[model samples]
Target chain A: MTTPPETTTASTAPAPVLAPPRGTRLTLRDASIGRQGTPVLEGLALDIAPGEILTVVGPSGCGKSTLLRTLAGLLPPLAGEVDRDGIPITGPDAERALIFQDDALLPWRTLRANVELPLAIKGVGRRERRARAEGWLERVGLDGHGARLPHRVSGGQRQRVQLARALAGEPRAVLMDEPFGALDAQTRAGMQQLLAEVLRGTGATVVFVTHDVDEALFLGDRVALLGTGTGRVPHVLDVPRPRDRTAHDDPATVELRRTVLTSLGT
Target chain B: MTVRHLLRLLSLVAALGLWQLLTAFDVSVWLRFEQFPTVVDVAREFGERVGSEAYWQDLTDSLSRIVTGFVLAAVAGVAAGTAIARSRLAADLLGPVLEVLRPIPAIALVPVAILLFPSNEQGIVFITFTAAFFPVMVSTRHAVRALTPVWEEAVRTMGGGRWRVLGSVVLPGALPGILGGLSVGIGVSWICVISAEMISGEYGVGYRTWQDYTVVDYPGVLVGMVTIGALGWLTSTAVEVLGRRVTRWLPRTESRAEAPAPRRSPSWGRSLAGAADPGPLTSTKEA
Candidate 1:
């Protein structure tokens, strides 16, 4: 069932006054991704339209992370290719950003500096990059914490810093590998809500990988459930409107959550 | 002021007291207790020589050799280690040679060093370099290899090329290990420089100790020993302080743990600082 990508209004936070540039379409062409000659995901074909959030849910070893890494161009596919805007992804590019679970903020940099890394790598001018980094940090609710080291902040706060870093580059696509997995449930919920708010009108396509079904349904326009036995995605559940937490308690979402849970076998 | 400090002072006093009693009472004629200098005599000699120009010259000579050798070893070791860890070609070419050379003690190479270099100073410096090089190299390699793959991947995914990845991720990620190597290298370099001086060259703390031994100047030997120990302590302290400064972004707790109160210095504490990733020869290499 086709749904309008941009027309869905948020039931919680108000949409941003001006929408950011929409993300480029990302597609996998019969891609087979793996580690060291062993295929983890084989013969997979999926299209992620621009300006949408796609969440991947699977059991621990079902290669959810492998799938994200492949998209980020960090890992080579075993058989096929991942393409962005119809061009093969040769390697990592500035247009796509990956958010790691460990909040891989350079242990040598302050929060502002970590957020500034991608811009610096892109050869952005000093003052402009710093301003953008600061803006992103403030948007992520880390206004005064920019000078703090990553280790000095809590796991939830570090996750926010990571999100700021990912978005600061104004990437067309963001691949998150359990970005909030290390945080507690309360913090995870808060981060998920914040993510939904900040990303609502930004139009940056996001592929979020998580084992939690509720998180998958709450934040994704489509929830992709990967079966343990099959290396490919078995199901992609579309929600009428994502970013609607009240929908989470509705009978329809509850049934969909059950379906995702059954697919995950937990 | 602290219990630890009190215990350390008491331990030192007890050691000196035992030595003084042994010499005073002449506990065993066969043990050469009579030939041993008393604590008071050694202390007086230490006091007398502490301000002497000859002692100062020896101190400067030894300090210069250790600092030069240690700095050279640190720079070369980190470069070589990065190359070896990051490139298969470098590892293949240099790995076996370094492995073979690493085991031979720098002291054992003193004669060979003298033959190879133009002057005794260069020869002594060469020995110290050899002593410092292996530990720094091995530790840095371990640090580089043990770096979390995510750090590099993060940089790469952000459009950082090879050199950017090396500068942004590899160097900083490997720093704790490099610092570990430096601290150990400084200590080892001191040992080697002094030993090389005593064995081959002139005008160093080790040489002075050896000279005193030859001339049967017993108290003078103690003075030289104390001087060498203090110099080694100061140099290692400087390295540790620098290490802490460079890694300031680390959590306060982790950084604070790296530099413990120098008074209660335990060998394992140093190892603990670098224990996040245990290199192959971590335990044995420090010596």
Candidate 2:
């Protein structure tokens, strides 16, 4: 639970707003990670509810990425626990999908084949995999791009294809590490809008990491402010709804934004 | 001429002219055109052999051996590379050993190879395998290791098993790299195979060259050398063409990874201008 700061919802500045619960999707408890015998991230705890967008905003090299890596099961947690619907965290599973910022699509794969990769790994039938991939591609507005190679697509589109690949498997929750951070401001905005729409339709829980305060407020159901090194607990804030955030209309959300900006240590 | 083309053409011509000049100057009577075969004599021998069924058949036999060795390496290399890549322990244990031995020329291994094998033929084949394996292994390992993590993540997220991931994501992703290795391997295999035969075997271009050497048929020996070089060049080029066909979707950067030149950006000015929404300054934007 985040400590609610002073009221500033009435202020002109943009802030965060929170939507009520659908379900508990992902829960982190005292989870820490280490690499090569040294600790990189320390005790961290948070829970993101279903249909909720939780943005993790933090300083550079703050183990924000490590935390996300632990969640994704790319790296083992050195200490503590992660719970997915009451089950203890284990090896990487289908319910927890992670999207990297760099797109990271295989160079040899076509956009459609890249998306189909996960299903193929699962040994899913070819026809079914194609169908699932095509549906998700349509959802992400990249239909007819199945044959195109990763290098042939624009950076933004490659990321979108990655987004589609993540969603195609129909995971219970999605973990993104600054997915839109690499894109230009305009493309980033369009992606954010696309993500919001996707989130709304699917009702899957999302825990996204980013550096931008505005992006966190605009997209997150709640935002967690992770500090620089030895990242402590987040100063979680609620995100405002109907998110046309350039003109903030509420005092509570505005107050939270100011509080978040301050917590960012600017 | 452009610098690269000129350099290539000049080196080749210079080499031939030097050989001719050396013959004219009679640098060594045994190596001179009087005692040895002039360029024309060897070319004539090659032309005469082209119309002979026995020569054509010998060429096929040698090709079959080289192809067999190359194919074996390809299959084994791809499998081993993926396995090592997926397992840290396997890579740690095997990678260093491979690297240590990879630098030793395959041709140099023929004497030891002959001692290990029962016959000259087996030794030569072993030599061919050794030449092909290292490059194939190196290529495969690189291809597998270089695969982006997102590909595996994508696979696991989609409920893919380890094997599925290997087959679907890792294998295809590594194809371009593997192909590059294979092209080099194919070229090297021929070199070693011919050397192996010349050193000890009873048949093939290598054996034929050694026979010519013993008989003082210097023109025949020159013909043999040219045939071996030409065969190596042809087969490797063919492999490269095949690799390109199989991995059409891979990026130019990755596909041409083995080549030594920096890539120039393709002309996108015309395409950009003709696009539905043209930018003020036209250039191909990497998607």
Q: Is the docking of candidate 1 incorrect, acceptable, medium or high quality?
A: acceptable
Residue by residue across B1-287, what tens digits does model 1's lDDT show? 99999999999999999999998787885677877788899999998897788988888988898888888888899999999999999999999999999999988998798789999999988889889999999999999999989888888888889999999899988998899999888888988888888888689899999999999999898888888889989999999998988876665554444353322211111211121212121111100
For candidate 2 chain B, the 10 contiguous residues with the lowest summed lDDT are B266-275
DockQ of each: 0.25, 0.25
**lDDT tens digits, residues B51-76, model 2?**
88866666776787788788888888
User: Model 1, residue B75: displacement in angstroms?
Assistant: 1.1
- As a whole number from 0 to 100, the lDDT of residue B203 in candidate 2 is 69
Q: Which 10 residues in a row give candidate 2 chain A its minimum summed lDDT? A: A8-17
Rounded to one decimal, what is candidate 2's iRMSD? 7.9
Question: Who wins the TM-score comparison?
Answer: 1
State the weakest 10-residue window (summed lDDT) of model 1 chain A. Answer: A8-17
Candidate 2 per-residue lDDT, tens place, A191-252, comes to: 88778877777677888899988888888888998886664776787766666755565776
Estimated TM-score for each candidate: 0.85, 0.81
